[model samples]
Target: MPYTTSPVLPPGTLRRSPQPVLATGDGLVLRPWRIEDAPAVHAAFQDPLMHQWHLMASGSEAEAVGWVERWLTEWEGERIAQWTVADAHSGQLLGRVALRDIVLADGLAKIGYWTTAAARGRGVAVRATATLTRWAFDAIGFHRLELLHAGANEASCRVATKAGFALEGVKRSAFHHPDGWHDMHLHARVHGE
Candidate 1:
């Protein structure tokens, strides 16, 4: 239970769930992470913008492998649902998307995403966000979804809006990165919205 005014959640509010591979009609494929993807994931993290915004960088294949292992642990612990965004036909890694901070009892989750340098400006993040948002709402019956990004991240702001999440407002100094504290923009989409 969320210990809030929200309705009591049904039984099985928290349990291990399968990370099924979801495919879109086009070429997008959302699937679980694998160790072999370490090099590619490492390459993507080499992007300066990704490292700056996320405050996470994989300098070695081992570190990237560890990152995937941690994500698998988070999934097994039922705390986060993450997927490696790839091309369905080509199977090339494009990015990653996640529904983290999952409060299943309250039917709410927050989304985060990043795209590889080659995939940016090509609608990859927007499409991935929309697909996951639809899955969260339709398949899981989640009532609300949120997207948050540093206020200075114009690209993320655009992706949030394109995914049908309205800009809620800014949270002052909500994130602390190596650079400094950053203001964050909060965007949200309700079930009926």
Candidate 2:
């Protein structure tokens, strides 16, 4: 096969740069996860909503430490970028957001997020999502960003919509939850859109 096109982004695009600390005008900061956040990470994962929507869970503080460590290490590979969404001034853990499953050749990645119980209803998830989306598109030059959620997760759907990601379609029986398989909503936004 003849290769003609260059990668949308060169390799090391992320690995070579320090993960940034982005601020949401609404007072949230999306920064790289730290080892000290393990306690909060452990508690956040215990939230029933987190368990319901996401598969990964931190059963103990030790496991949370491992999760935090893994999130940091993944940066070296530049495949996934995770951030701890915190209060800008106090640095209280508000939530988390990430650009996952990155494919630099295609300038694409999947965005995922969750808010702590206290952060819910405060626009934390929406602000974090929008902030990350802008950074992924404008700063990282990703051509497209996708946000998928279990079809029944109306909250996530709302976050995607508010963050400017259009609903592309649904994939039936696409995601397997602890209870059973669930439909998945595929929402996306192109760089200029």
Candidate 3:
């Protein structure tokens, strides 16, 4: 069955312009990633808390550089809008946030984030996620944004809730970890809701 609806955001919406830098209003900013951030990225991956959930190992700065390069291209491709969450004045890296798996026609994307150990207890994830959510809805015209995290990730759940994402339900065995499959909590926020 062919259902008809206009593309929610339209083509070239993201590709037409350079990615933007956004402020969290609490001394944090979300900006585009750069190659110079490789050292910080490598350090973030080495943190036990970050490694536990993301399971990505940036053993060398070179690998982190590749990740940054891919993120840069992903913006031009309109697939993902990744940002570096940083201190506004010092420009120190605090965390990372992104709208991944963006679908222009559907106007939907998945929210993802993680914070460095020093930024964890200070609500960096929540602010960055909320800041990105606002931009995705108001600036880019995304109709809906979803945030999914392992059911065991209480910190992420708190971030989602604080960012105004309502818990929709769980996806059983939705994601794979090194140990086994795990249930994922699905949270979402729709434009105007």
Candidate 4:
């Protein structure tokens, strides 16, 4: 499909332009990334499983902090919107969910997420993905949402299916994994008009 431009936000916003903290099910909360969360984010990124599955970059504590800082700047500048997934009760960081390539005019966006190994298989990704999809369609007025996963990642594919995204077919060599280019399964959900 088509990628749309980012949304434009009003002035003087320190947090995400359209700041929203969403709670998914009972255990997970989706909110904007915070600078203080760098340590937890750094530790999560160090996990080889996360690096392999999510294709995340390796970084130090300082680098993690910088990454969050840059994300904040991008959010404020209306470049990308990101959310940090955390435990609702214990307030522990779980992972992250983001609506990237957001184009307000087209009312479309893409969903991407990953949870820490400790939080896997607990429906964290599914719940968070569903929550974000709902928020995007309802609150943000998005008309469509898309998710893509490496063909080898069955768990990610399951999350998309569970969240009501229809399998849109596979794209050959759609993603450049660390090993090489891999085919990706594309999934999508359109808001009820």
- The models' CA-based lDDT, in order, is 0.86, 0.92, 0.92, 0.82
Q: Give one digit per residue, the lDDT tens place, for model 1 in 48-76.
A: 88878988878898999999988876776
- Tens digits of per-residue lDDT, candidate 3, 1-193, equal 7758788988899989989999989899999999999899999889887766886889899999999999888988888889999999999999899999999999999999999888888999999998999999999899999999999989999999999999999999999977688899999999998
- For candidate 1, the lDDT comes to 0.86
Q: What are the per-model C-alpha RMSD values against the true structure?
A: 2.3, 0.9, 1.2, 4.3
Q: Give lDDT tens digits, candidate 4, residues 76-174.
A: 654467889999888788888988876665666789998987999889989999999988787666778889999988989999999899999999998
Model 3 CA lDDT for position 63: 95
Task: Indicate the TM-score of model 1.
Answer: 0.92
Provide the clash count, candidate 1. 0
Error of 1 at 129 (Å): 0.6
Task: Report clashes for each candidate as comma-separated counts.
Answer: 0, 0, 0, 0
- In model 1, what are the clashing residue pairs, if there are any? none
List the lowest-lDDT window of 10 residues for candidate 3. 48-57
> Which regions of candidate 1 deviate over 4 angstroms?
1-17
Model 4 scores a C-alpha lDDT of 0.82
lDDT of 2 by residue, 1-193 (tens): 9669989988999988888999998888999999999999899889998889889988799999999999998888978999999999999999899988999998999999999988999889999999999998898899999999999999899999999999999999999998799999999999988
Which pairs clash in the backbone of model 3?
Answer: none
Clashing pairs in 4: none
